[model samples]
Target chain A: MDAAIRFHGVGKSFKKKRVLDNISFSIPKGEVYGILGENGAGKSTMLKMMANLCLPDQGGIEVLGQKPSWELYQKIAYLSDRAKWYSDYTVEEALQYGKNFYPDFQMDRAEELVEFFKLDRRLLGKEMSKGQEARLQFLLCFSRDVELMLLDEPFSGIDLITREKMIELIIESIMERKLTLVITTHEIDEVEGLLNRVSFVKDTKIVVEGEVEELRLKSGSLKELYREVYA
Target chain B: METRVVGSYRFILDFSQPIYEQLVQQFRQMLAKGEIELGSKLPSVRDFAVQMKINPSTVVRAYQELERDGLCEKRRGQGTFITSSADQVAGLRREMAENALESFVEVLKILGVTQEEAQKMIAGVEWK
Candidate 1:
């Protein structure tokens, strides 16, 4: 299987505090992989490294078989909880921004997603609720025809319906496109059935990693495995 | 645990087990019992995955296994359909019954039931 993303002996530090230590994993092409951990467990750091938002202090990382760079950004859609919108930018303006920036961004698909998510076209980013903001963020990310999508904590602070819609969109995208998706999330149950593989990051290390169904057969549900490891 | 209705088949899944295996097992049981009508069109892999909130590959695997077992067949452009052969359905029914009896006998043996006692117990059941 071709690897869409690979990390070899990767390490990261923040002000001399070890954040990730010798972490290594590879996501195969078209696989839905999950990065799971409690807050500050270096889950986001790993995703950011994949997206080239941050650099690893040591070792190397590969995205789509090549090193992450501005050129490779065209094939990757990276979405985090970080605010990408201007405070005053309306939903319509944000769609325009996506169109202007991402060459692969499909305006028609964005319009359809906007309708599916029931987002108000005139709603300003600052005026949107958490769930609404998440929907908008997902719309922007999902509309792009990128081969790899790195979503960091996509379900955080969203309502149940919003999460369901987001998941539906994720599932639809996977079925429609041959996409390799890497999502960092604490919402395990929501994404459990969707993930082909998962890794549990604890104290700057990958304590557990395997195919979801294989691990479940040995250790029960992914939720139970997490509890057993983190408890 | 999650319950989903795909086509005429009602799926109550055990998440601890591999989803594709559970789906294939359910389809087998349903086919044996004639619950899933012969020649009925099964849900497309994508539609079933979306409906069940599971990965499409899981559905594809299950469908493939069913096809391999002769419980279903996928026609190129048209979609998968349940086996229309009564002989195949009967064979599955007999296979399932044998499996059930094998496990039941094993349980009786574990309980220290002799062959004669097990036979007596089997005879004591009221046939419906």
Candidate 2:
């Protein structure tokens, strides 16, 4: 089993507060992995480290068998809750920005996704709603044919209909590209359908981790298992 | 009567069983009830997987199980189709009825109802 990303004794601290403490896990290649935990569980910090946006305070992390660096960031796509874009940039301009920044970005795919998502190109980044922003962020991420995708709370700002479409599109893209996706979401039941494996993070460590089915068999459902672990 | 999916027409998987087994069972029930017509094309592995938001490999395994059960057959390169066999259909019906009756009788035994009482109840109840 080849690993897409491996974390070895990884620890991160923001000043006095330790966000992650000696956490270690490996995401297998071509798998949809879910990193699940309550808010303030260091899920966002961990994803940041994986994407080379931040460095771990202790221990090592590797992506594609090599240490994480800005160079490797091209192979990894990160979609965060507070994604940055020029306030005045239109949807088409944002696509241009993505293509200019990431050589792996496919303009055709970005256009297709924009059309599929029904994002109004005339709307400015600052003018669109949270749901529309989520769509644009996803469009930018999926435009790049990368190995690893780190998604943080993708379902929060979107409506139910858009969220369903996002889930369906995520599955379609994953199957088509054989991507390695690591998602952090508190909505366990919503994402349960697409997850192959899940890890429950607590107290700055992975409290439990296993295939979704095994976890379910052990504790009824993912939500129940989450309650049992976090209870 | 023992449906595997947690929802209607659309499928939603549960954790108690592997996805392929659930899919196989669901397809078997569908065949027995004539919900899926014999000799009709089944959804492709990718299409079904996408619809269910599950792994395509699981869908493939489900189709394999269907073929093994003689409920469906795959025409290479084209797609899988419900097997056009009258004997197989009749066998499926019998098996489904036996399974339902077996569970029904087990419940009756647990409830301490005698066979004669159950027969009388069945006869007294009007079929609508």
Highest DockQ model number: 1
Which docking band does candidate 1 fall into?
A: medium
The TM-score, computed over Cα atoms with residue i paired to residue i, of candidate 2 is: 0.87
- Clashes in each model (backbone N, CA, C under 3 Å)? 0, 0
Shift of residue B37 alpha carbon in model 2, Å:
0.9
List per-prediction Cα lDDT, in the order shown: 0.90, 0.83
- Model 2: per-residue Cα lDDT over A71-131, one tens digit each: 9988899999776665789998898889899989999999899889999988898898878
**Candidate 2 C-alpha error for residue A28, in Å:** 1.4
For model 1 the local lDDT of residue B66 reads 94
How large is the interface RMSD of candidate 2?
Answer: 2.0
Q: Give the top-scoring candidate (TM-score).
A: 1
| Model 2 misplaced stretches (Cα beyond 4 Å) | B1-18, B55-57, B97-128
> DockQ for model 2?
0.46
What are the chain B TM-scores of all models? 0.93, 0.82
